[model samples]
Target chain A: MAWVTPVTNRNATARMTYLDMNRISGNISYLYNYAKDHGYDVQGDDVSQTTWTQNDIISYDFWYSMTGVLGEVREAAGLDKSVNYPATNYYSVNSLERYTLYTWMEITEPPEYGLLQNREGIQLQTESGADIEAGIL
Target chain B: MPTISEANKMQIRQPMDIMVTLQVGGDVSLTYSGYSDAKVADGRLDEPNKKMMPLTDLQGDGYPLNGSCKLYRPGYHPTSEEKWGERSNIGEPCSITITASESIGYVSAWVSGCESVTFSGNDYPVVNGTANIYVEDTTATFTFNPLYEDRRIEVSLLASGAYFIFNNDQIISCVVSLRSDLSLINPTLPESEIELQIYQDEDISERLASIPDETLITYSAGYSDEMSPIRNFYLSEKITWADNVMTIHAVDAVHKLDIQLPTASLLTDGSSDTGEATEESLLVFIRACLLYAGISIGIMPDYEDGASNSSLVFNRISLREAIAKATAWGRFGDYPTTWINYVDAGIPKLESDYSSAGWHIYEEDCGDVKRDAARKIKEIRMPVSALSFGDGGNYLTTNVGTGTWIYGSGAFLDFDDDVFAWSVITEQNAGIASVKSDETDYAGACERNALNFLAIKGLMEEGLPMGSMNTFYTQVMPWNSLQLATWNRYIGSSVREDQNLIIIGSKVLKDTHIQSFSTGEDDGEIITLDEAPIEGKLIVQHLNESAQTLYPNIAAQSILNMSNVTGSFKWKGDPRMQPRDSAYLHRVNGVTELITIENITITHEGGGTSAEITYRKGKC
Candidate 1:
């Protein structure tokens, strides 16, 4: 009977999965512990066993250290550089989007971030000491 | 035999192409082209690289699909080669030779391509230049000029396809060489002959097919764009081929008649009587002789009415010789005289007066000298006496003893003053009455001989200019009987002089018309003109008519000769000038006289055209 539905009658629902930060920190600690036990040097500034939270460890120094360890880990896993899915996924989603974000951030807040935030619903936070002791950092 | 219509058709339809086939041992090479293919083709024809394209789908009659066949140059292994585009290494040089065939048509090349040319000794320079060699009767040989070891060059001879196009309309050139012993006086003799040479590759068969047997051929001084002005000849033999050359031998029509027709005695069935002894005109006699030989008369002289008549008795001579004898007697005291001349169609024509056509001769310094200059003058030797009579004691006179009697009449210049007189008396017993009758017949025969001698003497006394006028540069003469006669008499005699030279004056004693003689026989004597009448015959005196007509004619002609400036002059190739045609000479001394061309020789070659004309001074 009506040509178009009224805006008041329209309703929609969306679902999203968030990143498990605790798991991520735990995985990083395990990697660091494995490297120390195997007598591999953690050759990077400010990258040690104490820096387990995502914020402290999300630096160029930590990333450089992780790249060295990741290469060894990849060898231990019998994986080739070209078929390294973790490295490939990290560069594809993070490095490309980071360059884009940096370019727009120099001028103004990127509207593209709104679309990303809405699509992924990701939230970044600093972990408390209690959370770190609970092994959820 | 082909009909005239068929011959005429063939004449118009000339062969368009010439085909040449060469066979060396087992190797066969066939070449064909249009008559003008080599001429119109691009580049030099003598180059080894030039391919003579054979013709295909030829259109014309008498051209075989394979072409008129002829043997290639035989024996001498000449080779040639042909290439299209420039290839870096054209392989070894191949020796190619080109020569002109005696046949008037077609040029041939021996090609041995893609072969190494080997010399006898030294390595010769490779022939690399393209040359447009002109084909003429001149002999030329193109060789490496170096001695070769093998003399045979290995060549890649490119095959010109089987069929080539040829333009048959090219002018047919030929060289006609006459036998060395040919004489104009007795042209019918076997020794007088002609040989024609033409290119063997030419479709001579087609040309010959167009020409029927006994075909008349007219020769000129040079290549004739117009009609020829020369005497005509009849083909008397079949064409012959040898060494890739064709030859044609021809003879005069009169000669052919002499060979074909039987003797005069045979024509008359061995009868002594030629015909009714009624005085017959010369024209009538000539007509009768030609009619007897189944020949029709064409052009003839127009003698004056009531001209001299002759009662000649033809013996065992050929028809032509008999006709000659008759003409000799008939021409006595007749103006211009008559002779049997043949036309281009092989038809015999009797000509009387001079021809109307005349040749124009200019001075040497005239503009376009080649077109007008008379090249040279040939003085034909004139006979000392026109007629001479010798009586060999074959007939006996009743009053005189048997002895040789001599008499002659043609005395014009001082050179002919000696009397050629002789008497031919028959042997008989002394004082025999029957001898008188035979004497009358003998006298009649003598009179006839005298008349013949006088006629021929008169004509020859004028001096016939028999030398050839090389009118090689221009064709200006027409075929006619007019001649040029030059006189070397005194200046005062240059004017017409009427000399009353008696042609014939004789008297014989016989019985008077009113009187009668009795024979001592059983029966009386019969009267007849054949024999001195036994009773009524009278001593008759006869005088020739030269005083009335012949003297004046001779005087007029003599004056004409004196005025004539006859000398041999070369003329530019003019096909129109023919024997007997009139020539008007413009002397440098301002003396102009109308003369006639007696003979002409036309020579046409690549260099130029010229005619050798023998002319005399006379109008008619």
Candidate 2:
């Protein structure tokens, strides 16, 4: 199933089964700390929660976690850390630092079958056609 | 034995401490040790990473976070087991009190900081992680004693007599290993690499962004003046960080080399400077590759034997491949010798008879260091039947050394008089097997040429038949001594073990025309490789001039008694273990046979650091 692009500053759900939400919070806090230490003015919420879950979608702000934080902070601070870093887009887009940090995210539309890995409809059948059952699962 | 302060070399080993440092320059580096303290609170049952200040869980059990060292995977039971996470310093401002309203309403407080509580009127003191108290009066106030101070950042209050645990699990892990190539006889540059895993910290997250390439990393273990050598593993720009973990992978000089040859030649064309114009010496070619890789030569002797001094040709290829081609040929005498190159301890070396294989410790040869149950060695044996001195009788002997040596005039029925070669086959080899001499082109009698050939191919085995080691190659190689020894394990006679000797693969041998003649004087006294030249420009006594050194069994009887090279032994990792080094292993019958290390892998995880050494037996 494809990733769902998180909605901006709104109710957004996440897959927290394998994902450690505290780590995500730590990651966001680290990003904010890194930008601040590198002499950049950035603003963010207190991600000090001990634990988090995908079910807690109320005011979760997944958008602020992904592309909105640094992407917006860099724009406000008049710094383009795109391909150049330390020198405003100095490092290459394919550089090591770009790969280490979560630089970008793309959420494609979910597959027609939805986000369930083991899609229930993988074995196709005509359930709407009530005349006869021809398919063997 | 391991070089330690004798304290660390006890029969039972201690839990070793590890130090992984990335050295960009001299003293400037980054070091990480395992965390020693943790924080415990109330909400950590469902939220493991929940934050709490003054993390002073002095008696909390430490189930060390995963990704810790494999050797230290079990729970962290420090020597002072009960007081595992306590700091040396302890202080509290004053006692605390809690007030309750109802008589049967017992209040349970799940405090993040200290949980030990004591009533003002009660005589006894209490200590623990959680506290619950009961009072019979309608309203009651309880007093708590002083608590020790640790790195208590913050703590939030929750309802219950519950306790949650959280380790300040700062360090994820680090791993280091040396990867080697498994090509025998050929000159291949094997790569050595090391990897480090650093868990992210909220304050110092910026360090991950500035990691540079080509930094040197050294890993050392053991608590003594002496340490194991896990050095020369270089760091590349390949790094990754996700889920608060950062990793860096590095390699040796061999792996990072990307030089293309025909490197700026002296001769130039009008359009461009090309390597096609002039053929350069092999020494020049070797230097170009090693120099470009930022690797110094092993400082060994530069050879000028046979065509080694002769100019050679090569197109645009990797500098490493060119080096292999340059070292395969160069006739020293009757036997053709070969040369090979490899990276040794960060230096590019042209090594063939690795002398360092003598002292490099793959296993505990001295038997001083204690070993664990995980240590084991497997025996590999590939045997042969017999060793025919020159040959048996026929030329079509399908085995490795079965063909008979022939030296009578016109004894060779198929080959031309000019194209002299051993009737050798590709038994256990892949090279074009060659031999060469300037005398092959000397304008003389067919018999005169044959004498020079005998001088080169050496005397045929009749009364005392000794075969000089001929290790020639086309594009590949790998061999052992060409001398015969008295180790008849099977049929009970002296035999020449498998050198897989490729003795006839040179320009003077392989590239010849097959001419034929009848036995009725049709060939006209062509040649004989056994006798000295009777007439043309030759002497009988001159044959033994450079011939004695080839057969080292004369005085000391230093015959390089060879055997099958398939035998290899494995041991656990030790920092001192180095590959390509040779040492003695007690094989049998009190015979401490010299073994050459072909591979070495030292792992610094799980229980303690161990080194696995794979060695080739008795080929020297």
Question: Per-residue lDDT for A90 in model 1?
Answer: 27
Task: Tell me the tens digit of each residue's lDDT in model 2 across B1-620.
Answer: 33443433455555445555443212211111111222221222212123322211212221121221111111333222121121211233123232223342333333333535445466322312334454454443333333444312122321222221111233345445453432222334557666666554433345445546766655655554565554565777655777776676877676545565422221111211111111123445456667776766645543432221111223344655445333322212222232233544433456543444444332343323232221121221111111123332323222222222121111112221222233333234322222323333221112232322443343332121221222111112222111111112221243333323223322121221222211233323332122211110101111222212111111011111222343444433445545555566654345565765556565554445555555556432
Q: What C-alpha lDDT values do all the predictions have?
A: 0.30, 0.34
Docking class of 1: incorrect
Worst window of 10 by summed lDDT in candidate 1 chain B: B466-475
Q: Residue B2 of model 2: what lDDT? A: 36
TM-score of each: 0.30, 0.33
- In terms of lDDT, which candidate is strongest? 2
